[model samples]
Target: MKYQDSLEQASEKAAQVKVFLQRAGLAAHPVNYAVCYDYISGHHAALCTAIEHKLSAKTPFDDFIMADLYSRYLTPANPQQEQLLQDASGIVSRLTGYTDLAAEQVADYLQQLDFSLLQLQQQQQNGENILSAVEQLRQQTQEFRSGQYQLQQQLEQANQQSHQLRHELEQLKLQRQLDPLTGLYNRSAMQHQLELWFTEQPGRRVAAIAIDLDHFSRFNQDYGSAIGDVILSKVARKISSYVQSSGLPVRAGGEEFLILLPDVDLRSASEIAEQVRRGVEKLRFVSARSKKALPKVTISLGVSLYQHSENWYQFLARTTDVLTLAKQRGRNQVASETMLALPA
Candidate 1:
């Protein structure tokens, strides 16, 4: 799909997500939308899978789940932010110290002024000169101004430090949303997108395709962990390319993936899943040390279209179950809910 088309699709998905949340009586906060959006977008495999499980079992969509999702995907680096806030807090403490010092100085000067006033009264009663009393009062006034000047200087320094730290904190939060390993968005970013999609366009259709590698454990056993990793990277690249710009590719876990295609139908989505299966089967990974071709790899996929009456969790769980069925009936096949259904 064209870049513009891709952008439009995301917008539509976010709107649909919002509607889904509203219908289900879930909170529609950005954090909630973010978690749902990421799941719907297929950015956070584990998160989407968890949500799917909840829906499949007709579990309650409670606040605890939402809070967990919010912290994981939407606000993963709060501790870092908290650390910066702590630094700001230190500045506040220092500012308070400066304030206290100024207060003490002011209080001392007031006492001195009171003494000066008493001295002037004595001078008047005894008919003596009052010049010393006036001089003392002037000195106290100058001392107070000097104290204020020092406090203002400290305040400016504190403000500058707080401002710089806030800017750095923002940058860290933005970078946290992207997964460094896969280059796709992390769970948090996907969650953000999901919320945005449903909040704006809740009626659009969504489809999920779950893919899991067959015999992945055998590869790890035969060639060591390093070789297994190579296979995973290659397979992930293939799946990502097959889905391309039109869909979201997620590395759900070891040897498992999910592709989310919004506004897509079962037939078309199944074809895409089948294509990925074939492409993976064709991949040839060579052992660097032995200079020999390694064992062949295959995948099983399950596809399911969204049903409005069903919760997001349920919709994904149904898709995952279908994928599991593909593995059971011999691996390396594409299966879906429609394919496993009984005739009317």
Candidate 2:
């Protein structure tokens, strides 16, 4: 009965060691075989020494026992132990193959993850570049808008200056076409007016009258030139007041004047010219220094009606010739080219 109890206690202790080895993740078959053989062969000191070394080396009990069995008992001469070592070697080789395959799979997975991270980083960089380009475009647009606004303001100022210049040009043109002393149309203005009228309405009844201040040089000698100027001004004012209401009066020369009458025949023009001569003969001028009545001013008039075939120059020449005849015949009288003889 005591032998049975000792056997049970030894069996229980061996079972506890097996459990401890298995829990430590060591091979069960190799460790159990090695421990049993060592005990049966009376090499208990070898087992104890191996366990102590394994404990010192921090090795699992089962792996320590397996290494001991191969080193001490599993040799080529012992065929049974060699066969057991071969089985253990087979199991370890299979386990190494599985471990190597698992390591390869893990390495491949890590490589794929690295490639994916690289692609994501590249996409992020592209997005940042696009944002930078958008900001640059916005700044350019703002600058362009500012430039356009300044251009618009400059254009408006230029337009205003152009308008003011045009108005000044018109005033200058008017001053050039007017006689400063008489306030009437000058000779150039008269010629231009006749030409414009003829072009606009051809074959119209138009008449030209030429008038001369009778004895102007004699009046300038007798009275001072200043008094003579007053007399001439008075005569010009009377003639302008009479003719400008019905026709156009122009200062033709120093002491000569011309009138242009549109839609008037030679008979009506002669009547108007005689009326102007009488009006001028009745003009009274006063000397500024003396404050006395000056001599009466008289003008001789000549008239010529425009012919459709004649230009402005030919008509004026004919009227001037008649004016010469009137001056030779008598002063303060009117004559026409049709009624007078040609100059000798």
Candidate 3:
């Protein structure tokens, strides 16, 4: 009865989400639905407020509202923001090296000036020829100018190289978190975010939505790896977009994606998982070469909330177990830890 109620709730929200989009004069699109569903399910309080404000003002809604909502609700700060800050600061500190070199050069110039003054005094005291002294001074002045120019050129070259190296390093750090195939955050990125959520914010609630593509191997076998690759890319792209800012979307393994929702409970997490499932279900795939439609693809999701006492590994294991149970019960259904804990 509880399972049936959740499905009924999902069905109702899905309908309301579509109606909200239509009434707002927004196109019924994936990105639009992601925001509306989130709002309808109360996953995004701020979004709900924004929509209410527009309605209260009696202003006509436009695409700009969607864009604004997306930026605010769906666009999460980069999980690697702290690391990026450190990397950027490190790059900027390279300029300090140049400053130190410049200081040394200034000291050398001062020392040269003092030595020249001493030489001039000695030349005068020794009654040396004024013309010869003048010639020697001219030679020293030319050498000083040439050396200064050379030092300036070297500093400029060093600065350019430092910038290039910093850019390359930043790119490498971003790549470390990204899956090469699906363009989603890889396992390492998810672990990084989870560590931050786990250790930094001890009391905060965290939930995991574990997802796995159904009969993924069947598609690979029937259409070849190329089509399978396309399917994976499309699905990952859809999942990644929905979790853009609100959560961390990770390509946990082949045909499996995990979304980490910070400060969320099991109910909200399951709703988001269901939204993802429905979005993927509506996708239509057709082959280019043969001009034939491909088999419909679906996914199973398991949601589990973090227990204050259990570590993240245990939390993830429970979620994965829930996912296993979901498959056993029926593929393409959303199951939660609560469901798993129920008496059989």
Tell me which of candidates 1 and 3 scores higher on lDDT.
3
lDDT of 1 at 208: 82
- Deviation of model 3 at 259, angstroms: 0.8
Give all TM-scores, in the order shown: 0.55, 0.58, 0.66
Clashing pairs in 3: 74-245, 76-245
Candidate 1 residue 318 Cα shift, in angstroms, is 0.8
Score candidate 2 by lDDT.
0.69
Question: What does the lDDT come to for candidate 3?
Answer: 0.79
Judged by TM-score relative to the true structure, which candidate is superior, 2 or 3? 3
- Cα lDDT tens digits, model 2, 216-287, are 988888986776666666677888877756478887755778889998888988988988887887767776
Tens digit per residue, CA lDDT, model 1, 122-157: 999999988887987898889888888988998888
Per-residue lDDT value at 249 in model 3: 89
Clashes of each: 26, 0, 2
Worst 10 residues of 3 by lDDT: 59-68
Against the true structure, candidate 3 reaches a TM-score of 0.66
Q: Please give the CA lDDT of all the candidate structures.
A: 0.76, 0.69, 0.79
lDDT of candidate model 1 versus the reference: 0.76
lDDT string, candidate 3, 118-172, tens digits: 7778888998855765666677678767767876886787677677767867787
Selected candidate, larger TM-score, 1 vs 2 = 2
